[model samples]
Target: MSATAEQPPFRPRTVLLIVGVAVIAFAGFLLLIAFAPPFQGGHDARGHALSTSGNGYAGLVELTDAIGSHSLIVRDTDLLGSSALLIVTPEYDSDGAQLARLLAARAGHPTLIVLPKWLTRPMPDNREWSLKVNTIWPEGAIAALDKIAPKLAVDQTPFRKTVIPPQPAAIPRLARAAIGGQREQQRLVGMGFTPMLLDRDGRVVMGKLIGRPVYVLADPDLLNNQGLADPWTARQGWQVIDDLSTTNEIAFDLTMNGFAKQADKSPLRLIFQPPFLPVTLCIVLAALLAGLHGAVRFGAPIAAGRAIAMGKRTLVDNAAMLFRAARREHRVGAAYAALTRDLTAQATHAPARLSGEALDHYLDRAGRNAGDPPYATLAWRAEAAEDRDQLLGAARALYRWRRNRTR
Candidate 1:
């Protein structure tokens, strides 16, 4: 019963199964964290560019990309100063002050504001789909712009929720750009701005701030996924994009749509965003390496050494330590010199009767005759030593003298 077993405590197959499951779980977790829907590479059913739902502008983003234009979804407010064309869709209840700050921070970049209109609720059974409750009130829809556009008014044409495609999408179909020209029912009757796009009604579906690059899109039906779902509307939307864009990059902002993890001054998300993302990944990799190293045994376990080592070297070291503590090493130089002289004499076949100065003189004579160095100077120096350093120095000299003379 006290014998070592041939088999290990854990079965090989069982251990492999557990490790396989753990590895799979960890990989899945990392994939989920690194590539979710908000990054525009996956599914999100909201009303933003990341969302592929009816009201989202994901189709417009794809259209931009297909035409060799760069499309980006900026998650950081720090990216507001970008000189590319920026498209923002702010929710009805989003902070007005934040919006003002965002617009102010644009540093003269061209921006297109898409005001929110639909009021919808996510379906309980399918998170990727939503149910349209109704249209948002015109006053509520346009109130967020009051800080920047105070004189801005919001009104829908009498025929409007016969709407959904920003015709003011009805005029192109009903009026056919009739001889009166297209101003029949403009969505924005606001004065002092240049119209960028007009329906057959001649209303400004898209307008620019006077002398500024900022443009306002009062009706989103012309750009939203639902609007672009139709072939004609999609074509019209693409034409509007191509005309108003001043740069190659088209950035859709989701911070105003409430998707920024760094929102609310939280620094925890800073590690997952740019510049710091690589650092965070390095830390994760180092931790995984540490865990892997700990999981496997690298070599045989080292045996515990005895508390008091048993050897001549240990005994010598202990004696040296004791002599150091008692300050007696300085007094042993002469004794060492005598022992070295006697040992050298025996090796050289000298007379056993030789002692003291006679032994030293005889050894020196014999060494000179044999072309070896004299031992007398080292012996004299060792005997006259006064401290540990001097003693050690003299002892080393004496050891060389004996070794050379004997050899």
Candidate 2:
């Protein structure tokens, strides 16, 4: 019985599937990292006081509280009672500010209004007791504060005390620092409030209204954290509060004109609000589609076989064709040289070479000596021949010479 032949299986579809899947998976991974939101660290001024235990107003919180409390009292009723309104403004919108404002409002004291720094543009003309403070810590304001309040000034000559490093996202660094006397002084002056300026050396340089109903604490740090624990700071804060509370209505202006100047322009009204959501959605959809298509189409296995096709002509065939083409173009000298080199290579496989005198001596040795033909007689007449007839004669002579040599 004849043996049955085994046939190889075809697997083009399987191979394509594997490649497509790999491409899709790589794209999905890249998209996931690109569209993910960044994680925020730390809390804001409002949250810092409630979330953590300690002197909550150690930094900007103290300043914000002071301004916010003052504003609330001025806006609502007289400060004669403990139930005064406190308004807190945020450098930006944040949960901490919201919580602080809500807590202050519920206390039956002052209603805390949380305003972001960006809202400064449409500020009302008569917001008597409104206080606006940045949510983020403003370090630059702290440096400026050192120059405004004599009681709040510290030894910043070495410049070491002036520099405050960035804090965790939860910690309001810069805004807190700005509550220092200098910032408060500037803010008061801008808002039509009486502010006293002090030099860095702790000398009061301006404004002295000791008995005025309105008492402003430029540096809130003097009343927060370690400052709160200090005898002088606490006494001073109490004195200022008591003096201001004498009036039927006490106003805390937490809003600083400096902050207004630095307030970032609203992006909502800008030419192009960032298209984060739309961009993210498009990227996610593209990734999902690619993955699904790859999974569905590339589930098969690939067959193992040679994918490249083999050519019929080798190096020798190529050289022969090149020589033939050159001869057809009337390049008889180049064609003849190529033919001679090929014949010589084949003949010299024996350790001896056929060249010059040796070639002639070998012819004689083979007893086939003949008179040498004129070298010029072998010249390709095609180069000088202008007519096709002369070219044909030259080609014929070349052919006859090749034929006789073979014989």
Candidate 3:
């Protein structure tokens, strides 16, 4: 066997390479997600306590606890009087704010209005003196407060600011009116005191006079952890409470609890029905059958074919046959003669033998025309001779013309 015959067969490595790359890519994707950060729970700004519950009740509970513990004293009872009360109002759906306000607005105290900032409409009564507390204070209210209480320390801390805004002057008046109404009604009902329920829009929809004094705090941010630290806010809250001294002081825990019970009382349970068993079984059986069919009816593997070699002799063979046919028909003389003339002119010996004018010129040129000796002899013999003689003479003349030039 030849050395080349012993060479090894070709092997394709593309499939293996692709599978290896796919496996590596999938592994990298899984690794990327594995190290990502875990989700965060809710936190209280005031007490720095974290709770799994998402409701922002931590701040409210902290504020209520602080007040209940008597850590912060309420001041300014002289001005608010025995009937005066502190009111707390929450902004938007701030349950924390609401709970805090409720805690501060307890019985016999100046009603503190803890108004949330998200009230859609304005209160119809438009009662002034209510102090509105919210995570965000309206720009107009803030601007107005800057004039009345410039020394008031607005909680500008990021967390504090997010929960509360600058206090407005109109807040105190509105809050007081609401508390006063509630107190007046409570005294009449002998239920201790009435608390004014103000709608989202500062309007006093009900409870104008419970005969008890009232102080409205429209903003709830004042009681937040951030607000508690502020001297002005603490002082303001104290002053509202102190003004209501003389009568019993009630600390209403108005803040909503973060862990408030959910209303969904139904217990979760799974029910299994026998009716769907047939359908489920049918689907599973269909899937299994399809998988089995795919496995069993799989097509046979096909092998690739080798590249084809192009034919060369097909072109050369056709050209040779055409030239032979033309010669047998007696048309080869002119062509042969023309070719001889060119060869003779380029030849050293044939140039002299073929030289001269007219017939000599023709011979010298080495080309055979009808008048030339070789071509004329061939043509006459071709017309007179019968059968193969004419063809033989034509072939001879053609050979002689070419041979003479070569000589």
List TM-score per model, in order: 0.51, 0.31, 0.23
Best by lDDT: 1
Assess candidate 3 and give its TM-score to the true structure: 0.23
C-alpha lDDT (0 to 100) for residue 51 of candidate 2: 12
Better of 1 and 2 by TM-score: 1
Candidate 1 lDDT tens digits, 162-260: 323354433332223221122223266556566666655455566777866878877777788877776666677677677677888899998888676
Higher-ranked by lDDT: 1 or 3: 1
RMSD (Cα, Å) for all candidates, in order, is 12.6, 17.7, 22.0
lDDT by residue for model 3 over 1-407, one digit each (tens)?
99888865543356546655886796566444432212223232211123212111234344545555322222222222233233333333444333333433344444543333221222335321122233343432223223222332222112122322333444332333222122111111112223233323333222322343333333343343334455554555444445443433333322231321221111211111246546655875797677567646578767666464346775656565785666554444455445544555555344445442433355535553433365445445545544445656765765566566455
Q: Is candidate 2 or candidate 3 better by TM-score?
A: 2
Candidates ranked by lDDT: 1, 3, 2
Distance from true position, residue 79, model 2, in Å? 24
lDDT (Cα, 0-100) at 214 in candidate 1: 78
True-vs-predicted CA distance for residue 352, candidate 3, Å: 99
TM-score winner: 1
Clashes of each: 8, 37, 90
User: Which regions of candidate 1 are displaced past 4 Å?
Assistant: 1-44, 159-186, 264-407
The alpha-carbon lDDT assigned to residue 31 of candidate 3 equals 40
